[model samples]
Target: MHFHGTEVRQQALTLLRGGSENAEVARRLNVPLGTISYWKHVDRAKRGEPVATRPSLLCPLCHRRPLDDSAYAYLLGLYLGDGHISHYAKHHVPSLAITLDDGWPGIQDQAETALRAVFPHNATCRVRTKGAHNIKVYFKHLPCLFPQHGPGKKHDRKIALEPWQQEIVDAHPWDFVRGLIHSDGCRITNWTTRLVRGERKRYEYPRYFFTNKSDDIRELFTDTLDKLGITWTHCTRNGNPFNISVARKASVALMDTHIGPKY
Candidate 1:
């Protein structure tokens, strides 16, 4: 459903002022996330409105919010390290910078005090306390850097589609504006008996998509993508699904060759 121009601007402004998740809000509003961000920022500037902070991240005592990425990064680093770094900073790193030669005992106390003030008191602080060397090793060598910082935590986790899903998305015709490939239409065939191995029987689901227009969708897609600063390409034989299937091009392409752009 297309939105009226004024309605679109109003929704965008609400999302911007509220710091709502752009993608979810856009999906809910049936507008592209890029368009939402663009209109939100633009409308705010046009109104000479002061950008406001989402209250969730503000310090309870001061009501101050993070002003820069570095500050957020520092908070994230600290959160990842848990109270371990803070503990070490308080008890061991007596000569550490910031808190002077005595270390950050007061700062550590204030942070803990600040956290309890913000989060539920029943939620215990379970930050693992360890020496600096061990903490450093964990961050550098761990496959998942911010393991505990998931979708529910104070940070937003990156959502990555599975390899096959990525392949389908990559293979999607680029010129289309508002088309969607079906979630469950894809299928994969045999060649697997002697080609690959697992301990026992293998069961899997590989998917394909429905047929749709290319260029018209591409115009809409391009408009949204330009606003969002994204770029994409037509699928090539090198794409994972293309490599797996017997067909050189996507089956969807076969159904409607006119829908796709030249690679």
Candidate 2:
């Protein structure tokens, strides 16, 4: 009597609790000799059950799982490419192995505990359900993605730019200079909406990119430095717009403050 996948799984589990030996379970269930062994661990548990049923595994950031480390690293690359952390957690699920929100309180607790280890000091860390047997933990800021404290102040600071002010900079004579201070460099200069009292607070993120070779780039860099704003810089060698000098400036901007608005 050949058993199907579902029957084999049930019999193997029954054998586990019934104290049946692997061979005995195989013989009694009339499955392959290695069937029990294979199915025994096929499922990775999010809580108490196995993870194989879902088939698709994804990370908490992107709603896809890696078939291998190469795939995982590819997802991480997308994360570095301007992917918002909150959006990642909100959308992605890790490996489908078992998310924190699998409706298993114990599993959710375990996942939360793991995240807490990474974000020991972050109070806003929490988990949400992604899909069947999938859960993702949400972390708001990019700098807080990893467990350890990042480069600068915890608080995300903002620069007040008038609507026309950014345009004026965008029209700068030098292409390099324009690139440096243009809207491209400033990702979040404007707010989604105005911040009013007794309502939710708004955060603004502004970044600048520069290269060292061009005179205009250098001038833009220096001018940005004089303004004392949050920025990250990368060089041709690094391939990031915010290079070492810009990082130093960015670090300075975040000094002496925790992230987010002060209560």
Cα error of candidate 2 at position 79, Å: 1.1
Error at 223, model 2, angstroms: 26
**TM-scores for candidates 1 onward, in order:** 0.18, 0.18
The candidate maximizing lDDT is 2
Error of 2 at 7 (Å): 27
Superposed by TM-score, candidate 1 places the C-alpha of residue 126 at a distance from the truth, in angstroms, of 5.4
| Model 1 stretches astray by more than 4 angstroms | 1-25, 28-42, 56-111, 116-263
lDDT of 1 at 52: 62
Q: Tell me the spans in candidate 2 whose CA falls farther than 4 Å from its real position.
A: 1-52, 57-67, 87-263
Q: What does candidate 1's lDDT look like per residue over 151-263, in tens digits?
A: 33221333333343223334432311112211111233323323345455554422232221223322333343344333333433333332112123343344234223211
lDDT of 2 at 66: 24
